[model samples]
Target: MPLALDVLAQVPTRREAVREEYLRRVIPQFTGHSIGEVQWSTAHGDFHWANLAGPDLLVLDWEDWGTAPVGFDAATLYIYALQAPKTAARVRRSLAHILDDPAARVAELLVCAQVLQAADRTSFYATLAEPVRCHLQTLASRSA
Candidate 1:
């Protein structure tokens, strides 16, 4: 996954998977930090299990590949992996360089907001709602 992300980082595109405006709106609502600025980079906008393959790491769904918050991919994969504690831990560890940084906080909160918003409309992400909320609260508290 790291290699895939590395390669994607080299690909160029002007698209923004997570727009600054969206972050401006949601980040403050959730984390209480008015977003000053976001670190953007090329990313697999949708970096979840369904979009990845085994044997050799294959990242599918190029449709959303574009500029995004610095650790968007790592934050996304981390959020999706929360259902599996061990897997989530591994992702957190492997991507600690990204996840541990304050810059990644925007990505994490954005992903959480996406999940929470989706939960309001469908049950697909409902199971993750609480966990995501807990994570958001933790982040919000940090900023406070």
Candidate 2:
């Protein structure tokens, strides 16, 4: 995955997987922090289990792959891994370089907002709602 990301990171694109407009509209509603300058990079935008394959780390679904916040992929994977404690821990450990950075907070909140917004629309993320909310609270508090 690191190898793939390293290569993907080098591919240039004017596209933004997650636009500043979207972040401005959704993030502050949850974190109460205004979106400012963000560090952008190429990412697998939808880096979740469904988009990944076993033993060899084959990342599928390139439709959303493009420029995004630096930690977007890690944050998305981490948020989805929340229901499984072990997986969440592994995600944090493996991506500590990105996840531990204070700057990644915005990406985390951006993902949390997406999860919450999806929860509002359907039952797909109902089981994840509370966990995502709790995470949002944690992220918001950190910014305080």
Candidate 3:
């Protein structure tokens, strides 16, 4: 896990206690789940608007593609939604339409997922985001 931790350190700064507490609360939910197994391979890892095409989506940045936990992509999309409120609402609506989980639970899980993603700072905002820093503060407050 040192490699992953190293990757995390490269990203934005957040309160250490908050981040750790968040991880502690969420990690147990997925304990014993296979997280490192690759199930599908895609040509693009980060498929946001920057690389998307009209009507037809194109995957770019293949470097991050690998066998990862299920819903990993969805989590990434949710993070993107956080960065863009309209998109996030749309994503939430879509999830509500299909997912059986309660909205509050889903939201909590999404936060956890975002924290997990942040744990790997190989992306652009890894080193430059204040929101995530605030998130860390929130996590710390919750733990306290």
Candidate 4:
């Protein structure tokens, strides 16, 4: 995932749901903005540990590359890291700039919704349920 803000400039977002319809049709309310209202940028459609090759710092899994909300890649990693709180914390700390961005919050919620939806297909993301709910509450509180 692209943690640095500069990484956004280095890549172009291919046309995909990350920037278009998912949030709107799938999740109507995210953070304080509608999906279409959020900011957009180039993103690795899928980003997880399995795709990363350390030492050399290579990234794999470019299957769903597209334009996504800014900081979404970081948000995706953070979501995937939920089962390992420490790793999630590390992701947050490493991508503080993106995670702290207003737009990133929406992206985070979108990922959360995605996880929740995935739970229906399989229990793989079940561990993230409570955390994602709590996160939504926090985000809602901030908006309120």
Candidate 5:
């Protein structure tokens, strides 16, 4: 899907699952105080394959729906796609503009940081840590 900027911009985010407090705390852990108000959007808060279905094409778990940082959905999808590199690459390719954006990159880094922070020591998140760390560093340097 193309960047949902115009549509998402019009929708005010009702923060809950990803509240401003969480973002303020998590984003700095990686970004080192580089905080600025990010572009918010109507996000599919939990945008994973399991939460999706075909034919009608629905996004599930309305409990978490709200305004999120512009690229949050794409970043979350990318994070979920990590086990399948090809799929992750496709996600990157499809949403390159959003993921490559400065504000969106911050959104991504925040997502990655939150993932790495809450990761279990001996689980799927553990496996994702290094790669996420690498990406976080790369994004941080690029932004600088």
Candidate 6:
């Protein structure tokens, strides 16, 4: 499991206190919800489109996988699907079937995910986006 804090540590603009508060609220909800260990047959830690094959959906980039949660890969796929409306709908349906409480869990995780992503200074936000930075700032202010 990627320590949410450790992931956030790579982000430059992160507010530590706010991040801690967010983690404190969410981590407990997953206390006993372990996804167990993943023994990958060549798992890709960065299994995004840039690393995959076009002919068949053979997942590439086996650097980030070791003992990740079962659905973490699926979650990355769903996030990629968000770029396409039709695919996103399919992904949502698929998630609904697999996850017991998908809605609530997704909502909570989205915030944390955004915060984690925002911590990466070289992300799109560092150059192109301001809304995410602004939103994080707002979250920080509210927490303050």
Please report the candidate that would top TM-score against the real structure. 2
lDDT of 6 at 105: 40
**Model 5 lDDT tens row, 71-103:** 888888887677678998998898787788777
Candidate 1 residue lDDT tens string, 39-143: 888998999989989888787887877899888999999999887889989999988878888888878988887887688678868998888877877777887
Between candidates 2 and 4, which one is better according to TM-score? 2
Tens-digit lDDT string for candidate 3 (26-78): 54442211122222212123434465555654545555543322233444454
Regions of model 6 farther than 4 Å from truth = 1-43, 94-116, 119-144
Q: Where is the poorest 10-residue window by lDDT in model 3?
A: 32-41
| TM-score of model number 3 | 0.41
Question: Against the hidden true structure, what lDDT does model 4 obtain?
Answer: 0.72
Q: Once superposed on the true structure, which residue ranges of model 1 sit more than 4 Å away at CA?
A: 30-33
Name the lDDT value of residue 95 in candidate 4: 81
Rank ordering of all candidates by TM-score, starting from the highest: 2, 1, 4, 5, 6, 3
Candidate with more favorable, higher lDDT: 5 or 6 = 5
* TM-score head-to-head 2 vs 6, winner: 2
* Candidate 2 segments whose C-alpha is farther than 4 A from its true place: 1-3
- Per-residue lDDT of model 6, residues 1-144, tens digit only: 553312422334212222234434443342212222222121233434466675755556655543232234444554454436587568657655332343234322333354345545655323322433343354345435
TM-score of each: 0.88, 0.89, 0.41, 0.83, 0.80, 0.43
Q: RMSD in Å for candidate 4, one decimal? A: 3.1
Which 10-residue window of candidate 5 scores lowest in summed lDDT?
A: 1-10
TM value for model 6: 0.43
Considering only N, C-alpha and C atoms within 3 Å, which residue pairs clash in candidate 1?
Answer: none
Q: lDDT tens digits, residues 97-140, model 2?
A: 88887777778888888888788677857778888877777776
lDDT winner between candidates 3 and 5: 5
In order, the Cα lDDT scores of the candidates are 0.82, 0.82, 0.41, 0.72, 0.73, 0.39
Q: How many clashes in candidate 1?
A: 0
Task: For model 2, name the residue pairs that clash.
Answer: none
